[model samples]
Target: MHASSRHGTVAAAAPARGGRGGRDRRPKRADAPDWAKPPARGKQRDFKNEQRAAGGAEKTRQDTPRATTSRSERGVRASEVLRAVAPRTSAKAFEDVSRGTTVLFDDPREVTLEEQLHYEREGHVCIRRAVEGVEMIPMVKAVTGEIIARRLEAYRHRVSVLCPDARTTELKDVEECKRALKKHSQEDVGFLQTFNLHRNESSPAREYIMSKQFAKIAAELMGCERARIYQSCVFVKEPGMAETNWHSDLNMVPLDTNDFVTLWIPLRSLDEDDAALHFANRSHRDFALPYWRTIEGMSDLEGRYEIDTYDELDLGDLTAHHGWALHWSPPQPKDSVPRYALSVCYFADGARRLETEELRRTPHAEDEWSYETWLRDLQPGAVAKHFELPIVWP
Candidate 1:
């Protein structure tokens, strides 16, 4: 079920206190949830350890075929890629001649489904007018306001409320929501906490929303065998927040196919005045260079801001060029009011590993360092493990 209907309640299985074994205990870290942590206890290991472990495990399994069971052999299981190819050109370079030439181009609504689907197939991304109506807007607006207040409080005043730093308020606010809910551990709080990861043992929200009705619809709409709630996130656009730079979903998990999607449900009525999130419309069709690069420079380096450089990458032009190029969340003017939205990501079943190795190697010193050498030594089987819960919302 959509988390909105189940908001403010917890499940019966929730631990009564903090800790893994309690009636409603969910994991917590400073301003972050324990669920987001690396899968292993030792957080200092590097990527080399992971590579070596992954490699070694593969080798051992190959050599002693009888030792491991079928499930054990299916490491990092997601649907296999239907095809592979040489890296293609960056879709960002294409110019849109239609921008001024066509009468229909002036009206975004006049754009046909064929145009959108064509872009989606080529670019691997697209967005549309998926929802509307005035009543829905007000409800989302109220929920959004509460979300913003909760987010602002959680940062303990760390948010900068301006460019560069401002771009990240959405992420910060999410961390805050997690912290607040984790701190209270009440049934109602737990329900709100499920905005991202809809798994709370004591979630009263889950009890009400866990019917098969929604799941069946979700699976049909999403075109998957099962629809599971993985993680939830909220997006808030206050004045001066940087337009979210261009990026892709796969870099976070490094998946193999287009087997995942994010359901973005706005909590307020969206209009021209509000900063509407623009998209490439079909960005997923191409191999998305880790969008993280634009923010962090490279996958291995700590991300630094390049506002002018990031802003200059014309998104509309790029979309027309390769179809795979797209971006969303334009910036709000310094004098304008902010917008609020809630979003969540869902992957095909068994798409993620614990990423303990990556976490282990990441330095906590808050400075630039390299994790490459460590990455080379990683063994296949040495990666930390993650387990899927028996989803029983119904």
Candidate 2:
């Protein structure tokens, strides 16, 4: 069930008032995200059936990755790699692309037959706490504002300080910067994304994105030996950012393979009303939509496919869906703090560019960043092996 189908959100101080947890979105720092603070001592909100199984404990049989049991001893848990990789400023993600110098364990891991079948039938699957090190995600909640401040500061430094242009606005602080970015990107209608933070090498996200843990999960789900990273993006949906219209990620990219998968990792516990992800079950199998529907606005495919989503995604829980699967999310009510999620896309190592006639004519100018950064100089049907795209698995 999606958020609208659920009756409650995270507990707050306003059960009696009955309006968005009765939150007052003012006084700057006082409006701390609830997930960052310890849960108040009181009656635990009736979560009904949803599980908060942290550190990979308390999982049902269906939720367990059957392939990881015996192999679990050999395969490195996600946390191990994160702790091993010290944050360094010089190295970028997958820096040792062909050289086999990565610190992570390189053993093959598999998904249970049931899980694979579920993904085949539904086009998406949720794996709870499989990426165990995501327990560190709560820290991301604290630094959400800092990320905004730092990024805008860098932008101001580049344009206003260095170039001395009248074009740039005198963005005062993080709040003003946030408003400017929201207006710049139509954050209510679209999304705010920062990609490849791992390129900085000093970012903690670098370990998570470059680690073989995510690559192995992608490979196992797609039944492939190798999964090459196409990109990693951290998506921020702030309070008051409206719901996003339904669209497919595959529609925006130039890749031409059915083996592509995107893993969505929540950096904190998500509330039912606050940006809960919704997917069109099995929508990828019948991909007749030939153009980028995002540019065209809300798609009308909801009538054709069933919407599937969890009421909530706890910290460490993640969802991996096929690139062609249609998905979107609801608005974050003004009561909530901004929610941050990391989405990493991986495809089979030998996947190539579009070869079909209709696909060849698709206008990809809107996504020129991806083209210049990784897809440049490639003809149709050529293997997508740009230096930026690295093979993260066997």
Candidate 3:
């Protein structure tokens, strides 16, 4: 077994009994604690009386009225028991017990305050069945096909023979674009990233992005008065794609606040072996950390944080992480199916653009799109409220 250590490294755990080393031999009673000792193999232990005894005197009193008591009588009995116990028990203990047993069976999708606190502290939270009953497989296939078609069209102009409807316009530029695409295609193109799908108002992806269910959760997780969808993209990672290097989204974007968040929704079920996303716990608080410029830079900061990841996640399960949270994914397995995921980035309302020379100088694709084009007109310290970044929540 592998366990994550405090410093984000994988720790080896002792193998289970009867595992590869044949370590199932029973321990001597002298060395084992009374609670740890198992009963004789062929003998049966009588646990009925013990169970009844362990339930205490209160259990007997509670059971006496179950069959004959009216609903009001049962409530009175419960009240009486509470009164009797109230004097002896600490208020905190009683409160804890009450909280432990208080269940609202009707609202199954509720997120408790404790969970919100965890998200605040860890900078990320995974919510199971966040968007149920939505068939993601078909959506994934459609988006994948669209991206491929778009890429082919962009590259076709470069190859004269490949262009079906060749016109006399801009042949030189077309050839240049095709050559660039051909070179990229020859390499291990890790994933097909189709960004700004929401810009196309008629796209199905746009409708999904604007759904109230998704926007509400994003707003809640962000603890923002409102949230706006700044960017949306579909990532299709084919088999044998290279691992995504560790990095923080905030460093790559021009946003001034750490209130920015990203929602990662996988199109299918994924296990740990499927290159599921991994995060460095509470690393979002490390604001002094410089922008990750190289793989070596990421490695240097590994020891400062503990890594967190899900062992398995079903479809409809999604994860939301702070923009500054350090995260990465392993390389796609050679034999596994392509991994398709939709990523939507949300920024808190009133977020401003940062004036960082480093961000301006960075040659990353995200910087170019998010800063150069999206926030081109807005000066540093200006509000990030461009038409391209629309508010999705209130």
Candidate 4:
């Protein structure tokens, strides 16, 4: 889902291949699948034209009186609005958190029925002050320093830029690379991405990800007896970093269950304009919606869903979302400070591997890494219980 060009341009979907009425059979791009490759420059222009035409139709629909008045005419409550948009079982899980039914992770084992319902219904929940902002400062600084060092090394060596799992463009020289990095930092082209910090037991990020405090909450939210660490990454969104398109983590994962969760921990306070993550409330239940297999597809889905975002997210406040939830973030304001966030993904203890061709052909670099590093050796249909997937919850 993070597929993009070396310059960080979002890849557009290729036209359906084969013949009209036949199955799509677009040719795959070299080194990646069709879904991962940026559209040909010529195709991009055509796509934009198509989008503009469709936008006119969409505006007309929104202007219709029926569309503007439907929800208001029914006097729908906040909870009812969610129910109307979500599946029956999912809608029923919403609880009145303001009525003191919200459960903060004071005791992870003490997850209330209301808390569990909230997670099930909304596909996410926020824990205010889950960790002190001061506690994350050192970790953020350490990761940022590492990214710069790595970039410098790649530039000096005249080698390809190294991302978490793939090589990007080759740098001309130190100065050129610096200029490029600076330009990209301002254009939302690239961000500092480092993955699996928990591999180093001494890493501050590892300490946070493996901490019982976080794992217990993840386990409780997942409604699992225990949880395993699936992956961990530090995403440093430099001011003006590009928007992350809408997509579900589940589609990228090779697991066959909905018992996965991601903890998004911001290293600093963020106002709405600073590029906070947003969700399509209860959209996790809309599994039938096509997986955002391409950037174009994700953009299309964005036009179809109502996005929910927090206007002001404070430091230490953490968001936990189900793996299947649809979420995205806009580019940070150019004048804002850089955004550093740590994310840890967890899966229920008993999840099993999904043996499907689609999983095998997932075009994203991260998905490829997940398959090769975490699941390649496991037999299809077997429990996803590799040692790499360490159990963090009891």
Task: Estimate the TM-score of every prediction.
Answer: 0.40, 0.64, 0.62, 0.63
Encode model 2's per-residue lDDT on 1-394: one tens digit a residue.
2222122232221111111211221112222355543233232232222235332333342242211011112222222222232333332333435411233334423566766876788788776545343334533643354356456553433233223222446776556655554455322223455656655556655665676766777889988987788777777776666555555677656677788889987777664555667776667887454433222212334444556665555665578899888777756555566677878888888888664342522332223334445443455567776667777785
lDDT of 3 by residue, 1-394 (tens): 4454322333232110000110122122122222222223223222234446777654453233211111112121112211122121211111111011111122235555754776788787777666442444445555555666555442332232223234424444545654554544333334556677667776655656655566667778888877888787777666666556556677656667778888898766664456567776777886555434423234334345556665455666678888888777656666566677788888888888665432322323323444444554565567776667777775
* Reference-based lDDT, residue 108, model 2: 27
| lDDT of all predictions | 0.31, 0.54, 0.54, 0.54
Q: Which ten residues in a row have the lowest lDDT in candidate 2?
A: 13-22
> For candidate 1, lDDT tens digit of each residue in 165-212?
243335445565445434532211101111332334443223212323
Cα displacement (angstroms), candidate 3, residue 34, comes to 49
lDDT string for model 4 (176-230, tens) is 6555545442222435556676766655445556766677778889878878888
Which stretches in model 2 have alpha-carbon errors above 4 Å?
A: 1-110, 133-150, 153-189, 288-299, 355-366
User: Which stretches of candidate 3 lie above 4 Å from their native place?
Assistant: 1-110, 133-145, 151-188, 288-297, 356-363
* Candidate 1 ranges with C-alpha deviation above 4 Å: 1-142, 145-149, 153-222, 254-257, 288-326, 352-394
For model 3, what is the C-alpha lDDT against the true structure?
0.54
- Please provide the root mean square deviation of candidate 1 (C-alpha atoms, Å): 23.4
> Model 3: C-alpha RMSD to truth?
24.6
Tell me the alpha-carbon RMSD of every candidate.
23.4, 15.0, 24.6, 17.8
